[model samples]
Target chain A: MSKPLILVTNDDGITAPGIRKLISIVNEIGDVIVVAPNSPQSGKGHAITINSTLSFEELNLDGPQRDFSCSGTPVDCVKMALDKILPRKPDLVVSGINHGANSSINVIYSGTMSAAVEAGVEGLQAIGFSLSDLKWDADFDQAEEFIKEIILKTLENPMPKGIVLNVNIPKLPKEDIKGIKVCKQANAKWEESFDERTNPHGTKYYWLTGYFNNMDESEDADETALANGYISIVPVKFDLTAYEYMNELNSVYQ
Target chain B: MSKPLILVTNDDGITAPGIRKLISIVNEIGDVIVVAPNSPQSGKGHAITINSTLSFEELNLDGPQRDFSCSGTPVDCVKMALDKILPRKPDLVVSGINHGANSSINVIYSGTMSAAVEAGVEGLQAIGFSLSDLKWDADFDQAEEFIKEIILKTLENPMPKGIVLNVNIPKLPKEDIKGIKVCKQANAKWEESFDERTNPHGTKYYWLTGYFNNMDESEDADETALANGYISIVPVKFDLTAYEYMNELNSVYQ
Candidate 1:
């Protein structure tokens, strides 16, 4: 039996505490290869570098870990690692320990989830992990056991093709943590209010600011699971086909 | 009755002929305001600018259009337009005469579609328009009538709340075109094959490239509609709740 090859990456640059923690965890489970953006690519969804040339440099940043920092989006890092750097197909790909939550609609805007989604598109078992806390020094000690368990479970029982797990952990002490809950993404959204500002030239511009509004009171929602002190695990599929509305729309088109 | 205020934008910078044609189409229909990226932001999906300052300059380009080239993503341009530029809430938001198709799963990574999705999130009626071809010299004349018809129809009859249209026009003569088909996004995806290359330092990197593989043979799909020379309009909503799978997974979690 061979050791599982684990490809690790994140939206928060390669040296961020989040991916460092992720790399440390995966190192115990499998052969770890880290390819992440040189700078933070937080909200850069599935963006690829079309106009720019991608560059990567192998770093001797840590002990026994192979790391490469790339000048591209999170999706680019995954593509580069899988298609250029890695000698063979990785058994699994994991993104994040992202600084912010990618639990609900934020998944669409998250570079962390996009890395996992990119791997899922390539038929690899993938998972994206995030903490509800956005603090730079946020503790990930509580999530270690569950994350490792989930990764091992995913490796033992592979995920469905094109599906990835989006796991959001609540910020809590290891003992205070509730068990994991498999749930659906809550029907929630970011209610945006752009903060108006003046440029140096006295011209007006805006900065995007928003409050996350979780309107779903459903018992099985990821938001509810997290609020109730449970680690929320949502099996997210990349196929954006609104299957239920198909028949109704087909009738209209016909 | 007062003229409806139409906010226009695109993923292809404000200079693209496609958007110019779109602005011209809507100018006749309503009072139009154009706010788009200064550069192409093709695959930047639902991303927002947080790490950097954004700027928008009113361009003095020669045309009937009032354009502002912004230093941000498509979603940013929309927020800036609504919050800092437009005096009041726009009656409708129309994004793109995109240089490429945003049909099927591509909608998840599309900046053109993101602009419209952002508008829809802000509780405004929005539509994203795309052409099948990616040519800078692609014919825009053939798109006028169909664009007008769809936009007028959309304005006349409101779409469901939180729903935004991801409309893809076949790059054929408008007369040869079959009527509009309200379709669902096909189960289609990009089969990514990265073009690996060695840099000046002899280190290898990868350029992400892929071909679209259609998995759905259903006649009601956007891919099917587009292939049949019909304009495919898939009403896309951002709420990613896989409701049916919730209860089933909840039992396992419990």
Candidate 2:
């Protein structure tokens, strides 16, 4: 049988160490195509460039995979790849090894996870991987074996339609890792404290700053798993409808 | 008793007719404060600006409500409002009367809905309203009474935490419109067809374009309700965890 076709992309741009590591691992598993944003798209969520045009250029990155640098957000890259670049529907789509954790509430603001979610919306099996460390030079190699194992396992057992995987690794050594845990998204949020500052012109401006507030102490929560040094995998769905509340809402509308 | 404090915002920017209509209606219901983006932020999803500084300027729009135009995405507008703008926690948060439909899968790509989701994440009662018409000058005045009714009802019945309402009005005249129906998000997606062209610099560029493809024909779907001329109210939740598949996922991981 021919190799499985894999589409690889990330929000940290095509050249980020994280995606580079991700691409390297996937290359061993499938025929890889890298369509990633040309610049960092952290926190871009599911943004598409609707008001403007987009472009892409082929790059000679150090890999067997074909690389295309896209001039849009991470979600845009996935759309562009499926529409204008890929020769066939990929067997699997993988996003990130994101520079920071998208463990809980961060998933909604994550370009990394959004790309994966967009693919899932298109009925493709997809996964987004992130590390808890936020540094550009974070040690991605530490969890290389585990990442490969997770990808292989997922490719064998494709996720259900409209569902995708959000995998986050703790910032620990490979030996210190306590394996994987399937968990629910922790009920958490960022308490924003915008840093008010003045520009050189003496005009006031604010920088977005926040602290993660995790309120879920449940053992099955992703944050709890990560805190316990386990790699957390949360099955995320794009069907945002709250089915349980439909009857209650119907009564209210009446 | 003190009047309810309502925070108003939208993705169509501060000066759009849709938001103007929203502000007018919200002003009648409570003490209103509008903090929306300075320019249009269509299809921005749940994006938040983290790489740059943001600023807001007070505007003298023709209303008893106060207006502030922020230089950020819709989600940023909500975070800025709660963190630095509002004097106290708002009693309710309403977003849009968006110039286009945020029904079905469009809710995932909507700036208007993202703002409402952001408020929901903050544990506030929130709702996002949109009109089926995409025209800039869509007759938002037609559904004024219905909009007010929905807002009042929602204020009276606060949604459970992590849940918000996505309300979409059909394009028919107010009298022709059927009553509202609470429904689930339809199984739908956008079939992307990128329009490629040659730029002035002789480089190839592409425009993102897509057609909505609704596969769901269920009577209980939001898209179906809209097609039947009924206003659709879908209860949207942000906790993406697919709980039903947790056991299945756990087995695979093990």
Candidate 2 Cα errors over 4 Å, as ranges: none
Q: Candidate 1: misplaced stretches above 4 Å?
A: A199-205, A247-254, B60-65, B196-206
- Candidate 2: global Cα-lDDT? 0.95
Q: For model 1, how does the per-residue alpha-carbon lDDT over B88-134 read when each residue is reduced to its tens digit? A: 99988999899989998889889999999889877899999999999
Clashing pairs in model 1, backbone N/Cα/C closer than 3 A:
none
Query: Residue A15 in candidate 2 has what lDDT?
Result: 94
By summed lDDT, the worst window of 10 consecutive residues in model 1 chain A runs over: A245-254
| DockQ of all models, two decimals each | 0.51, 0.92
- Candidate 1 local lDDT, A1-254, one digit each (tens): 88899999999999999999999999999898999999999999888887667878899987557999999999889988886789899999999999989987788889999999889878899999999999889997778998998898888777567678899999889887889988888877777677778878788766678789998889878899999999998888766655566565556545
Q: List the residue pairs that clash in candidate 2.
A: none
User: Model 1 compared with the native: what TM-score?
Assistant: 0.93
Indicate the residue-level lDDT of B35 in model 1.
95
- Please give the CA lDDT of all the candidate structures: 0.86, 0.95
